[model samples]
Target: MSELYKKSLKQIRDLLANREVSVTEVVRACIERINTTNKQLNSLVYVAAEQALEQAEKMDKEGPQPDRALWGVPIAVKDCICTKDLPTTCCSRMLADFVPFYDAYVVERLKVNGAIVIGKTNMDEFAMGSSTESSYFGITKNPWNTKLIPGGSSGGSAVSVAAAQCFGALGTDTGGSVRQPASMCGCVGVKPTYGRVSRFGAIGFASSLDQVGLFASTTEDSAILLEAIAGLDERDSTCSTRPIEAYSQGLTGDLKGVKIGLPKEFWQAGGIASEVLGEAEKAIDAARALGAEIVDVDMPHIPLSVAAYYIIAPAEASTNLSKFDGARYGFRAEGVETLDELYEQSRTQGFGDEVKRRIMLGTYVLSSGYYDAYYKKASQVRRLIQQDYLAALQKCDLLLAPISPVTAWEIGKHSGDPLKNYLMDIFTVSLNLAGLPGVAIPAGLGVESGMPVGVQLLGRAFDEHNLLKAAHRLEQAIPSIGSPKL
Candidate 1:
């Protein structure tokens, strides 16, 4: 990777602001790096080389302003987020020819702040799968070890940052999509509080669960990006009207007097690999050494999180995705005459297997006969899960846990059993269910594959400042793992 690609967004921004490097050089270097490595990693599905260059030249001609947070920085956005010109395929045939006429709120923020959108990264179809293999565009490979799978559905976004294809990227995290992929890729990924970031333009999988997430080289970079994109948007009713905090100012790395909650459920969860657990321990020890107090907290209802999440998310997904019927937009079956047949044939042909599976499961749960028994029950359980975290947080500032039970697994490791893939999400789905903020940072290398293992720091709703501060503190103690050689 070129040194230009290796630099953080902050570093790149500073260089561009000072005219130390032209915006054209920075963007062209990023595109060149993506071209060289993307064939192997399959991280980026689309590259708007001409448009990005055009923007770069425009930015170069107009001198950078001191007030813009991300002036002249190059960033990649996940394919699921709506981009005005770039094809937002979501790595699925369902939206193969789809292109939004306007940008997603986050994309609009990036552009207005002078950040260049190099391209759209790949992702699971409609953000439904834990591995990127479910995408119609083909699987995205782990940069650490090509044979291993990069966790999804934000796998491409993670790989783009890890491989230095872009300084940072935007991804949507419905469950652990952003954090899991960041963990496997050894980068920093953060999902803000549910309504903290506007969701106006992103293609929805599960409307209640989805949030625009940030992937960056460090927590501080994530904070900078988050600060720029997070705020009230009149377009999205779900977006919080609360005043946005200055998140970057909170990164003092002073853990003094901070209480870190260690949940019993996370550590005792079955199938948590020993190496990942050990890395979590090291992070706890590092926090303790920095004057933070570790407290034992109980979240008895956490085991029910995955069960509730699957029900709630899929149900929302079914409703949100219902608009894609042949009559509106996206793919439409050519030969179908009847409306029902067109809807059936288009969906059957447009969607991949994983997407269809979730849609069916969602449809079943929402069916009249089973609605109360399944979806209603799951909704009730979800409230309990949220309450569990609320109660636990009362005793501590934030919760600490392993991002995943294991490191990146080999491709096709759990392909035979869909339930096994769901099991992998046990640690992550709960946070989304609770509508809290969680940041995943690399703890260290694991014992088995020598790949990166990450730990999550989850905080209260709308309190991403605390999570980013704690994460940045822990990040300073751990050695930086450089970009993988392709």
Candidate 2:
């Protein structure tokens, strides 16, 4: 097999721009890599080999287009993002055979910029679980150690980039889905500020929290991809009308005069693994050595993030998923005698255990008498968490924190305990709740587990340019975790 698939997205872009490698060769190399490794990793649920090759050959004949930023690049999309004529199952039996008739805003943007839709990747059912194990398609294995998990629900997207199955992949970050997986898989994952990226065709898990994110091997490559897809879209009313920044142009690799705040709430929180904390400390030291100022900032309400997020996210999920009844296009149950039976039976048979659990919890919270006590209280707490972030950002240009409390664990380590999985997202949920942009860059390998550890840089809403610039500079200062042996 060709080693072309091992190159970074930027490297491949340059190669294609210079006519050093044909688009056909690059796409073929990636397809071959996916075929060889996906059986073991289970990263991609669908591989569009024929369609991708056809598009690549057409692009090869047309030559590179200067106006298109991603000219000839091959990228993967998480299964939840709608792609015309492709399965957008969300990795649940509920949408098993359903294919979207239209492309998502990001997919349309990527195609316009010359990116090939390589395939659809596996994900947690309806983006509800912290681990990809909840997918009906089967769990995605960590590339570093097959027995361990790849943090999710965006595990497959992170694994695809880490294992070089594709140059870059798009994933959704709703309460840590993208960043946590990137941390475990040793990849750069970016979740733009909410409304910064259009959510037009992304299947809603939590309407208020979900935002499309991307994963790549390096921060610069992430910046490139972000610039290609971000901007206003009339199709999504919530998408910001603010001008998009030239994200890649901001990468000067200079952290001079940059102030990075370390939150006391995040660092002092108990239960953080020793090795993970050590790696994060090393990253702080690296930033200090690079002419950056480090300061301590306090965010008292941040500790309540996970609690607030679970309530608000699932409540929105309950409202959004009500459309999946058997009456519509998705998976419909057979042998249903009554309309009520069809609704109940189709849902019972379609959704997995985790999805059903969240739906019930969501319905309960949004119920008549409990609404004021549960969902309403959670909304108030969410506001306080957002206030904490806004106040902290005023003290520093950006905040630096650990992406997850621990490294990837054994596949079934928390199988029987769902709360254990929820608690692991303590560090990442705040970003989604606050609608802030964050970038998770590999810090180093854990001493005990030998798995990847990542540090996230959180910035104010709509400040992705500065966030990506800081992440790129800090990324250079830290030691590379290197590629997975897979």
Candidate 3:
């Protein structure tokens, strides 16, 4: 039954339905794996052992329902995404004891689709860092090599899926959080279009950029989950009223006549790692072999994405986090004389260094005197970047690039420089600004490190179907790309 952990959600459902393996055994296996490896990697912040076993016990007695797509598969939640009974801290002390009153929209959908909740995964504190090293809970090590860092801020969710602690996991992506970690961990992860999935209960980072993302071993699994979660939501005003597509329905489909765009600017770079670039080129060649028409395209303003993301993401974060001042909710300070003291002390005491740093940065950019110089300039750059993508899409069906410049770096290798770590996210952040759909599918493992390398496929806004179909085609072409070493 060791093969159980490597099977896709579709395959898992089939095995359980045929009574070849029980849901109880599946849940038990995942629990055992988590117990064995979690201490080494710190992938999971909380394990829902009792809840998982109870749910599995119930499923074991009841025969599988044909309509339930993920019936019996266990999945973990990124701590930032609210779960009904689990603490949603976003991996920081500021909200250490905070439990949600309601599940995030994606979590609720997962439960209704019959996926058992396994645990909550760790993340960078308030989703600020590219490496999980910024997490207050400590860095999440790469599954391939324990010394290397898993990419963040969705590091724990990616680690959980890669480690087989769960069949798949849910994460939130503001910039490269989900895609970058999935790339580093040798897993397939998807970041849906902005507002594709409702963000009702997720702790806000960047109001406009944050979107719920998912991790799996194959494009098929990611597509299945995307279908269930993507839809119009009354809870999120920013959520589009556009109809959600069947992201999995077109699998086993070839990319014949599909136009794939390779952004020329992405290749000519000082920030890119040579090995990562070579793997991406190999992936593109394989896709080309499968009847895809490759064209060189450009998103000129993409270079400014990093600066724009840092400004906008934090600007929104500062305001969203203002609610955590120990006044009415969340973690409160032990002793304070006045309301002002309570607010300051509670925040100062509860927040981690990274969280405080981002808050200060956010406040600085949004301050009256600096507002035009920082926030407004970032907004203008964001518009140009989105326009760049829109123009490129006019020339192609879908766009392709690397999710991250390099494979997982050694944990803490980037100790003193936040700018260096932030630059690793350069390639993935533009899509967030463009409000487009993107997926990071494992291309192959690195030569020396043998860590995973992923190529990102992006689609026009709300056009997830095109992205998934292309991903499914390329995944089949790639070899030994699924199943993390962990």
Q: Show model 1 residue runs off by greater than 4 Å.
A: none
| Candidate that would win on lDDT | 2
After superposition, candidate 3 runs with Cα above 4 Å error: 1-3, 482-486
Candidate structures ordered by TM-score, highest first: 2, 1, 3
Candidate 2 shows a clash count of 0
- By lDDT, rank the candidates, best first: 2, 1, 3
- For 19-58, candidate 3 gives per-residue lDDT tens digits of 8899998998889899989999999989999989999999
What TM-score fits each model?
0.98, 0.99, 0.97
The lDDT of model 2 is 0.93
Number of clashing pairs per prediction, in order:
0, 0, 0
Clashing pairs in 3: none
The parts of candidate 2 lying over 4 Å away from their true place are none
Error of 3 at 46 (Å): 0.3
